[model samples]
Target chain A: MADIKSPVPGTFYTQATPDAPVYKAQGDTVTVGDVIGLVEVMKTFIEIKSDMAGTFAGYAVENEAAVSAGQTLAQLDG
Target chain B: MAERSAIKRLFIANRGEIAVRIIRAAQGLGIHTIQAYSEADAEMLAVRMADEAICVGPAQAAKSYLNIEALVQAARDRDADAVHPGYGFLAENAGFVRAIEAAGMRFVGPSADTIDRMGDKVSAREAAQAAGVPVVPGSKGRIETLEMALAAADEIGYPVMIKASAGGGGKGIRVAKNADDLAQMAPQAQAEAKAAFGDGGLYLERAIQSPRHIEVQILGDGTDAVHCFERECSMQRRRQKVWEEAGAVCLDEGIRDKLCASAVALAKAANYVGAGTLEYLYDSAANEFFFIEMNTRIQVEHPVTEMITGLDLVQEMIRVSGGEKLRFTQDQIVRDGHAIEVRINAEDPILQFMPFPGQVGSMRLPEGDGIRFDHFLYEGYQIPPFYDSLLGKLVVHADTRAEAIVKLAKALDELSIDGLKTTAPLHRALAADISVLTDSFHTQWLEPWLEAGNLTATP
Candidate 1:
């Protein structure tokens, strides 16, 4: 299975907020439609969901890191 | 009392560097200023620099910059005596100007009627022709059918440019070199014209070969007007000016005088007041100048003219709207040195000038005796995607054109911006090229140079 990608160019957030519970962690088993992270651009937040079901190989980028279009985020083990 | 009273408080009805530029001018003149912005521009440099700032609406320009009611309401709330439309949003909107006047505040520009007349390209062309300005050979008015366009093209000859009569910015423009080409282009042009300008009216003109795009800067109060020389805007990508320079390098004295005189004549004919530009296509080899259009507001390239003429066009606009006569006569207007302006956009030039919006980390502008940078970018400022990618303008002036080009190259090398990519490298490379360095260029220079791997510096 292929990895899900970011929909827009922005900063990546792992969870809702720092004090809130983490949505997904490193090496966590996830499925299609599972919440991966959030991409925030210009104060607009959008959920990043996995398109394939598999254990995460950890995110390719760090939380709050600047990202560009077509940049890889996570790798799903087929 | 209203006629003689200077503008005490001015409201800038736009955003970005132009807003900042106006604010500085107003401050210098002891006028309190207010800047209105969209939600996306909360942290913009212009907002931070203004004495007062208010959020007009969301990121979308239609709800913010183009929102007439919101702009007028803000002007009223701030108790502004005059509203300067700057360049883009409502600068040429006749209705907005009328509303501002109706609200008992001065519109720092020509009367609403003049804007309306020049906003319509067909009427503007007729006005220019009547004022002894040479216009390109083309159709007289809007074309309703393919047959009509075909007939007009036949009379005007082939290799003609078809354009939307109601729009600018190179939208809905197509060139047909022959009969077969015209057959395939007419309907497509009409559809594009309709979609872009909400008007399907199309006009045709003879497309001169590699003509340089030149424009004369004119300032007026109602009774008299003066020309502030000309700017050569031939360097373009996607039909939009990327780089511009004052005093077209190729045009000789005679052609330059003719172009400037025609621009002044057209402005007088339209009763145009304030800072406006009359754009023309100058065929240097033939020494013929054809009037293309007149921008009914201040232009993005006005600074280059300012660099050469030592005039504050925006201040002139304000004083004129206050009913003051034009201070300078035509003969007294002088051009000193050569000046060039390059629009530095926050775009990845290698990616076809795609917008590269991100947090601007560390911004360092170029500095020199003759270099001037007009921008709104700041450290930690996130560039929004809802508007134009123009980050700033870098302008330079020197005693000679060759010296100006050299100075521009040096200034560009010193400039640096961290975070998202920009077109600085592309400009630097273009400046260093032998063709551009020696002033051997045309309107077709930049795009083809990039495509041919000329500007290969990585972003």
Candidate 2:
């Protein structure tokens, strides 16, 4: 198991917008370079991408949760 | 006057240095403070220092600090008797002031009507003109059509400024050099204003070329007002003040007296209460000054004034808001010496001052007599990326301007913020710049100097 950490400090959004679908779900298959979530700060958005391929275990932060740099956001289980 | 001592619990509806400043002042007044924060500010020092703290909304500024309803609700929930908007976000917001008032809690600044009157640039201009204050030479009020705008531009002469009536934070402003530029920029500026501020109201003013940016600090009790002298803050980049000094040495005593008196006049005309600032453009060559705009809250550089005057402006503001009158008269106020302030932000000057949002791995605040550092940063503290880039302020005082500059430069050299990039290097370069050392720089000088790649040192 590996912890996915956020690289920026902002509010984590599981979806692109309010009307969009969640970028990833529990037990979903993931691959390296796949975008998982977004961090919104100062009106700018940065995409959080996967670095290692694995199964999406669970999210550490809730939808629209505030996060800081290096804060764990998700878990990947092989 | 109604009793303001009734305000025992104060709600600080802001964050960062200003929030900390207000908290200390309120504490000194024997009033407890509650810090209203967004989710992003969970570890902010202000939150920890306040008597009580609560998260009002999400991380986004619009949903948190700028959200009027959320802030008011937090005040109610915290059982706060008054709310201090603390300079930004909702500081000059009329709707926020009105909402706070409607909740049966005192808003620490001026009334909503006063905010509305001074917040609208066009109306503020009219008010200044009505009060015998000399405003910039353009635009009687908001100009609706391009033809009218061009007409005003021509009358004000070329190189006019097209400004959003509701603009702040350096947004929604365009400088037009001629008729063609005016035609091209007016509508584009209008669109941006509407998009950013939700108010597209545009007005024009003759650009005061290379004017020294000076502002007078004032305190009022909704009836009487007194001036706290002036600060020379021409050292700005992209319209944001970076370095400020109290007691502009360039000003002759005669001009200083007039400028401060005029500031008091404008504040009284607006019925301004609490601490506020009236910005002006000083045309040194022309030997005249013109009113620019008034900030209806405490300023970031308030300590510079405080150091020279030996008065606690924030404390006085709270006392006045609590139904007290001005504590000191004009005669009692005196500029004892020179003071300088430099703002350190989490930005890289080489990358056009790009915001470097991250955790502050470590920091060393310089300490000495006549030196003050106002910041919320702590070792291992997450410098949140969601808010303004300002990380801290370094203020120093001395018996003379020369000594003050030397002390400021030395302090900057000692100050360090590890992990994240800082504008400290830029400030270090400024401290070395001959123009800054000589106190001869103008408002438009810093950007070009920065573009010349002078900020090379990293501290």
Candidate 3:
């Protein structure tokens, strides 16, 4: 199992906007550099890209939750 | 005769440096300050400094600062006599102003009707024209169809700008050089405006080339108004003003008088109350200015005007909101020196101005004559990433523009906020740039300068 962590401390979102669909689902194939989520810091959205290729397990944090830098945002299973 | 309803308890319905600035101003006037903060901002400097602080909601601004109902309820609960919406968030929200007034708490700004009127681009343009203020030639109102846009473009000439009627902060804006370009761009602009602001309305203006962003600061007491000269905010990145200067040196005395007078005329005509800024696009080549929009609240660059005019704009606004008359006549208000204000945002200048929110370490601030730093930072404070990147504003004033630049350089060098990245290096480089030194830049200058890797070599 691999964990994807947020690169910055901010509000994390699983969707592009409030009404949009989630970027990924459990058991979905995850490619390296694929945007799994976005971390909104200081009103600027920075995409949280995957670094390892695997199957998407699930989001470790709830949508719109405040997260700290290096906090686990998602999990990936090989 | 109107009795003065003194604002004994002032509730600050905003956050960050401007919140802290408001708290200080209120405290100076012996007003008990009640600062409203989000859950994430409980530990902020302003929360700690205010006479009392209350948590309105969660970390997100939508649940907190922008929660108009919650803010009004909180202010009422705290027995606040007045609410001060500083700058952003709901500062210009007409709904919020109405709610505050309905709740029996005075909103320290113009009336909700004034905000609604001036906030809309079409009505504001009409108001300016009615007041004899010059405006860019364009469609008289919102363009409902492609045919109207084409007709307006034909009459206004080519190179017209397609702008959203509901837009601010440079969003929903596009420039088209010709009729074909406008035909292709207007639908996209409308769609974007609908998606962003729930309005598909769009407007048009003849795009001014190489314009300097000049604004006049005016304070009105409903019956009378006076101007505090003007500010030159040409140095901007992404339509966000990075550096601002008072007494735009580029304007000759003749033009300056006309510009300031026009601003006062608008304010008087609108029966404007409190402090407001009338922004304009000045084509220095043509030596002409055109009114763009009116911000019906105190602006971020207000301190630079205060520095030069020796006016406490915040206090003045509060006083006016409390049924006070105009304090200084136009002839009595004097501009003494040149002032410059550089925004110190919490962004890594080396890494594309990305937001850098971290725990503050040891801090060193420049202090002396004609130097003022407005901020909400402390030694052990952890900056929350839920807000904008503006950490502070370092303002400097001197007898002349050149001397002010010299002082700004010295002050920037003396300041330090350890354990976080900031835009200090960018300001340092700009202070030494030849174009900036000679005051030859315009609204479109800084982005190109940054794109050319000007900040890469900064030490």
Candidate 4:
């Protein structure tokens, strides 16, 4: 299991928008180039993507939770 | 003049050293200090030092610092009698100032109308010209067409700077050396201006080669203004000043007098109140200085002026905002010694000055004579990845410019912030550089020196 980390400190969102479904959920398959989440800071939102293909295990941070750089976002099962 | 009211409780809408500075100033005046912070600034020094603290919004600036509604609401809820925007954020936002005033709290800066007048580069120029200040050779207003831009460029002479009337912060500016250059650069500058400022207005000014960046600090109480001399802030990168020193030693006494007078004239013309800085480009070859722009709020390097004038500017701003007259006249204001300030930012100079965010593992600050360290960082404080990377400001003073530089260098050597990459090493190099030591460099000098790896290689 490898943990995916946030690249920036901001509020993390599991979905693109509040009305949209979660980009990725537990046990869902994600691959490279997949935007699993978004981090909003300083009025800018950045997409959090997965680099390694795997089954999404679970999120370390809840939706809309504050996160810091290098903090775990989600776990990936190879 | 407005009716007078005491600032019994003051709220500072900023973070970092500036926030700390304003809080300290308010405390000195026996006014209770309230600090508004984002969630990320929970452990900040300003938060700890203020009389009261509130988290107005999340870590994102738009929801907190720059949000006029949130800031005004926080001030009102805290029962803050006044609000001091300690630079950046919404400091120069006239709309924010209006909102604060609308909430029945005095905004500790210029009036909303004054800010609106000076915020626009085009009208600011017109106001300065109306005051008989020497302005740069440029177009009267925003030039919309390439043909007009080219014609203005030719009239202003070669090597013209095409700038966005609505743009600032080192963006939407281009230097064209010839008509061909103008043709190629004007459209690009316009496009950038449109994208960045939501305004496509363009203007032309004759570019002064390797000019020194000098600025005059002025204090006003609605009708009258006085200058507190000038600061040589030519040590800049991307138009963001790093190290600043009070008194441009290169200027003769006569030139200095006129420069300062021009600043006062302009400030008075605009009916500016509180602390404002009028920036200028000093051309040594022509021995003339031309108005560049005006910063309508207390600037980041204001400590340099404070050190030299023995004037607590933040306190003055608060006093003036509360409808009090200036405590002292121009003749009574004494200029003492020399002062230098170096901004310590959490950035990796080796990595193209990228912001380095992390916990401050341990820290040791310089102490004693003529040294002032303004910051909110404590040991183990996690530097937020959001917001600006400025960690603190180190200011030092001495009887002479040479002594001030030496003192600043020694102070930098004693300063330490472990577990974070800082610009301390770069500033130390600048202090030791012969050109900087002799005060021979200009605004365009620092970038190429960094590009050459002088911070690590030569020094």
Task: For model 3 chain B, give the 10-residue run with minimal summed lDDT.
Answer: B1-10
Using Cα atoms, each model's DockQ against the true complex is 0.07, 0.43, 0.90, 0.31
- Which of 2 and 3 is ahead in lDDT? 3
DockQ of 2: 0.43
Model 3: pairs clashing at backbone N, Cα or C within 3 Å = none
Give the alpha carbon lDDT tens digit for every residue of B213-301 in model 3. 99999999999999999999999998899999999999999999999999999999999999999999998877889999999999999
Of candidates 2 and 1, the better by TM-score: 2
Higher-ranked by TM-score: 1 or 4: 4
lDDT of each: 0.84, 0.87, 0.94, 0.88
How many residue pairs clash in each candidate at the backbone level?
0, 1, 0, 0
Best by DockQ: 3
- Candidate 4 residues B15-113, lDDT tens each? 988898898888988889999999888988899999999999987787899989898999999899899988888988999988988888898999899
Which portions of model 1 miss their true places by more than 4 Å? A1-78, B1-5, B139-204, B457-459
- Candidate 1 lDDT over residue span B1-459, tens digit each: 554437888899998889989988888777788999998789888788888988888766778899999999999999998999998889999999988988999998999999988888878888998999998888987897889889999998778898988877676678998988888998899888888878888889887878888899999887688899999999988778988999887888877888888888888877777999988887666667888888989899899999999999888888898778888799888999999999888787776665677778887788979999998888888887666778899999999989998899898988899997888888888888888887777788777788998776533
Candidate 4 ranges with C-alpha deviation above 4 Å? A1-3, A7-65, A72-78, B1-5, B140-158, B161-204
Instruction: Give the winner by TM-score: 1 or 3.
Output: 3
Rank list by lDDT = 3, 4, 2, 1
Displacement of the residue B32 alpha carbon in candidate 4, Å: 1.5
State how far residue B153 of model 1 sits from its true place (Å). Answer: 8.4
**What is the TM-score of candidate 3?**
0.91
lDDT of 1 by residue, A1-78 (tens): 466787667667777898876676667798878988887653456689987888777777887666766788777776
Best prediction by TM-score: 3
RMSD of 3: 4.2
Candidate 1 residue A1 C-alpha distance from true site, Å: 13
